[model samples]
Target: AQSVSQHNHHVILSEAASLELGCNYSYGGTVNLFWYVQYPGQHLQLLLKYFSGDPLVKGIKGFEAEFIKSKFSFNLRKPSVQWSDTAEYFCAVNPRLSGGYNKLIFGAGTRLAVHP
Candidate 1:
């Protein structure tokens, strides 16, 4: 079955530090990729997405990712992150569904602890 996976279960960093979270998916056909972030006590919001066109895509909050078709990877990266950037990052994928609302499958979860 097609699914998305986040390699990092937990990450710790200091303010103004760089951030990189690994993400991967298992799918052989066309698919839509997305990165959703959930701040403390907040709901999930879209960070970035890759549907078609260029392999590299940028998202809000200074976050970006590259879609490498060969590796089946879409890793999130940030040059320098602030304390506010600390949140639970989730990697998701939208696969073609035969029925239903074509829900999103999220990664297990990644808790990012950023210290000031």
Candidate 2:
């Protein structure tokens, strides 16, 4: 079993400000990590994910994440953020299991506020 942890519960930033959200997982075996975002009144959308191959992956909306195996982390980063970026971010991990089925364990979530 694995759990996800997000370092920052909430974050505030201004337009053009750089953004970084920390995420870590507990499982040590083959796993898949994802970053999901939910706007003020929208469904959860995938931001980025890391499964295999390259450690770094880029997702929609200028979002990117680096998977550091040693740290068991997949932190999200954006060089410059916009007011539209205001949303709740979540980190999730999917552990490999038998029967070819797995469930995602998500973090508490980080609420982001962007000011103009």
Candidate 3:
């Protein structure tokens, strides 16, 4: 079955450190990729998305992801993470069907802790 997989369950980092979070999906069709971040006590917010055009996508707060269709991967990255960046990150994918109304499949999520 098609699904989304997040490799990291937890990630700890210090301020100013670089961060990389791995995400992979199991689908062969064209997909709409997305990354969402949920703060400590906040609702989930979109971090980035890729539907067409360039594969490298940039999101809020210096976050970016590259979609590698060949490997079915869309890894998120941050050159320098801050304490405020601590949150739960989720990777999701929605394969565009012929008709409409696609469903988003989400990964388990990765909890990130950034220390000051």
Best prediction by TM-score: 3
Cα lDDT listed for each candidate? 0.89, 0.94, 0.96
Candidate 1 lDDT, 1-116, residue by residue in tens: 77788999999999889999999999887778899999999999999999899988999989999999899899999999889988999999887556645578788878898899
Question: What is the C-alpha lDDT profile of model 3 across 24-84, one tens digit per residue?
Answer: 9999989999999999999999999999999999999999999999999999999999999
What is the TM-score of each predicted model, taking all chains together? 0.92, 0.96, 0.97
TM-score of 2: 0.96
Name the regions of candidate 3 deviating beyond 4 angstroms: none
Off by over 4 Å in 1: 97-102
lDDT of 2 at 38: 99
RMSD of each: 1.6, 0.9, 0.7
Name every residue pair that clashes in candidate 1: none
